[model samples]
Target chain A: MLTKRIIPCLDIDKGRVVKGVNFINIKDAGDPTELAEFYNSEVADELVFLDITATHEGRKTLIDVVKKVSSVVFIPLTVGGGIRTINDMRIMLEAGADKVSLNSSAIKNSAIITDCSKEFGAQCVVSAIDVKKEGDDWIVYTHGGRNKTNINALEWVKNVEELGAGEILLTSMDKDGSNNGYDNELLEKVNNIVNIPVIASGGAGSLKHLYEALKFGKADAILAASICHFGILSIKEVKNYLIKNKINIRL
Target chain B: MPDISILNTKSANFHSVKKAIDLYNKQNIITSDINEINNSKGLIIPGVSSTDTVMQNIKDLNLEKIILDFYSSGKPILCICVGMQILFENSEEGVKPGLGIIEGSVKKIPKLKNKFKVPHMGWNQLELVKESEIFKGISTNTNFYFVHSYFCDPLDEEIIIGKTNYSIQMCAAIQKNNLLAVQFHPEKSGKDGLKIYENFNKMIS
Candidate 1:
């Protein structure tokens, strides 16, 4: 049977892990490669490195960081943030990233999703949609979840899947950083509408929350950042909990 | 010093395979050179890309004949994902013919009654059917990273060494003499994945 994936997300800036990871056992908390190695030992199914770096030089640093991290860790890696063009996706894939997540660029020029998927297989393209609930409907947000778009979240997900995106990385802006849980309502609706895999992102506070996303929301994977970064929960612990709950998790 | 050569299909990600081999202190060369591949102790056909494109690239580079030549040499050759798909005679994904090294056909994963996704993406466990050197250190039912819509259905069931279930039991790995092919990406499958490469490295050595 296919196992549910547990992913640890890292925010990288200028080749350094920006999020203040306060794990005492970690010798270098800022080193992205070191953190990735830690996750590997913890049995993380996958890793997502969100490049929070803004400048061109930072992008270059992120690429180098990707190469370095991929060389050290053997698991699948997904890189997102500031990936604007096909060339950017190519560079990241060549640097050993298994998948590239496109957010704002995909919204601005949806053709990029088709083109990238055509050049590289649809499996390489990940359509990342950031949404916030409004008036009983979820609205898509861009520009790092600050600016809102007129496009409806459910509709955009359907469009991306049709556009050849292999998977959907759905993040709820309202639930993001809230430590509450995933927006199960949004996840349930989107999962029902799309045929591709949906990765639930943002607001993963506990093991039960991750379970809810997979059980109620029907997410194929869960992306957690704050909980893992602050040493509150390890990937192994989460997998164990999921296993005990009869969830088919990769342990 | 054993030399492992990764065939450069132009579309495949050879770096991850190379890196995996590098961890075991073995040297891997990424090349389209027929002579280099023929001379290596082992050859790895990595994944990523459609079957048609990969076949066309191999034919264009004239590496297809060399691959067969290497296989005849009886030195181990490992094919991964799309690489595994092309080992068969034909595929539902492309019009081009496969290398025909293995008697099988690549078909799209059939949709289940419950509607499991087409591209069986993410981590999945391998159900070993028979013992093989490729999975020497890896335990049974160990999860490996997979991302594909099509799967290989071998005409010879005896060749199958591993199977995985998405909606149904699919052939995940096969072994026919010196030729070993898997539908999963060992290089992207974490520690257990690396163990596969390590086992392969030991086999060739």
Candidate 2:
């Protein structure tokens, strides 16, 4: 049976993890390497390191962090943010990331996803879409939910899959900091359309939220930050809760 | 520059496997290529990860016949980690069939009641269960690094040369005909690990 993964998302900037209340007002969490080792000890099913630094030097710093984290953590790690070229994907993977998540770069040049997937493999490419509700429809947002694209969220997801993305890491820009719950409506919309694994991200406050995401939303995986980074929910505790809820977990 | 000689359909990082070979050769260990085993030189196929997938990969590359040819020639073939598991009949992890060089299927260590991790993930000692050229320098309880979730259950019990207790009488090493395999990482297993590779080197030499 395929295990429902429990992932912890780390927003990295300049080799340090910075967690924000709602993607703003960042607070230094710790060294990226240390956080990675901690998560490995906690038996996180997977880890995602998003390099939020938009500068060239920041990109170099992110690669350094990836190399450092890979040496310590044995579990799978995925790195993203500011990745523009296939060489970037190759370098991050060679640096120890099991997968590479592409957001803005993918939106800019969707062919990169297919090209990278062909060169590497589908299992190694992740397409992250930031979605925010626009009236009766969900619109795809880029630049970390600041600019809404003309494309619908569901349509973008389908496009990504057609482009050979192995998985979709869907983030709800609306419920992000509210912790009200996952955008189940949006998740279902994308889930019904894409055959690849769907990882729900943003707006998970408690275990019940994760349950709702997997149960009602039918997400293959859950990606949370505030809940995990702030000790509101540990990966083990969440997995245990999910198991009690009859969801498939590695534990 | 493609550094990997074999494009594994599963794990394509042939560079790392080549690195392991280069590191072994630096220690004065002679490693034989897969194409040369028929002429009497032994061949080493060390697998650090992905037993089931690697087996599928070999079949995908259409190289199983060549491997069976090596086995038929009575040349020594060493399997390391998951590589050892592929020497068996099947594995529970994937639907792909193994080489059937040995008689058993690989299955996960039954869910243990205690906290000994599934992949084992670290170095542990190998206690000899029988005599073979592979265990020449390795002593009783000699530590060798291991990282795997599945084990081989050779149909012929006599071929089980050594056992390492993780959950069951796990086959640490198996020897039959000219085939030898170990469930530990020799490249990362320190001096003793190097000797295990050296023993293989001697066999092939």
| lDDT of predicted model 2 | 0.72
How do the predictions measure up, each by TM-score?
A: 0.98, 0.64
What is the fnat of candidate 1?
0.94
lDDT of 1 by residue, B24-134 (tens): 756778998867777789999997889999999998999888988899999999999999999999999999999999998999988776479979998898999999999
**Cα error of candidate 1 at position B109, Å:** 0.8
Cα distance off (Å), candidate 1, residue B199 = 1.5
* Candidate 1 regions with alpha-carbon error over 4 angstroms: none
Output the chain A TM-score of model 1. Answer: 0.98
Two-chain DockQ for model 1: 0.86
Candidate 1: give the clashing pairs: none
Lowest lDDT sum, 10 consecutive residues, model 2 chain B, at B1-10
Fnat values, candidates in order: 0.94, 0.00
Pairs of residues clashing in candidate 2: none
DockQ for every model, please.
0.86, 0.08
